[model samples]
Target: MIVRIMGEGQVTLDDTSVIELNTLDDELLATIQADDEEGFRRTLGALLDGVRRMGTPLPDDTLEPSELILPASDATLDEVKQMLSDDGLIPG
Candidate 1:
């Protein structure tokens, strides 16, 4: 899975990481829905960190279509809220 962290390029996460990503996605979605800024920030950081850990970074020139596009590290709550989908950031 090619996951793109906005402003941070992309990473190719393995298929095995889907469930883990979904968990984080669901958590992030809840935080956003509840307007929990602290939770949102924390979850976003974890999610991004997870992606970076489980996936290999793609080269700058290897711009392939991303499977998921997450908010930037510095994204605001409102900014990330607009990026959410019914299934959250990481699709099932």
Candidate 2:
């Protein structure tokens, strides 16, 4: 799966990484629901860090469509809330 971090380029992640991301996605959703700013920031940072660690960065020239689009690192809680869906940013 190709994941895109808004304001950043895309990264190619495998199934295992996707699964891990899904777990983090759940945490993110929970943080949002609980209105926990610290948790949200921590989970969001973890999610992004996981992607960077477990996935391969796509070349700038690559144009493949992304399967998931995550908020930018500096995104506000309200902005992240706006980005959430029933399945969250990364579907389980």
> Which prediction has the highest TM-score against the true structure?
2
Clash pairs, candidate 1, are none
Question: Which portions of model 1 miss their true places by more than 4 Å?
Answer: 85-92
lDDT of 1 by residue, 1-92 (tens): 88899888999987888677888888888888899999989998999889988989999988999879888989989887666644456442
Across 1-92, the per-residue lDDT of candidate 2 in tens digits comes to 99999899999999988887888989988888899999999999999999999989999988788889888999988888776744466553
**TM-score of every candidate:** 0.89, 0.89
Q: Report the alpha-carbon TM-score of model 1 versus the true structure.
A: 0.89
Model 1's alpha-carbon lDDT is: 0.84
**Model 1 lDDT, residue 5, Cα:** 91
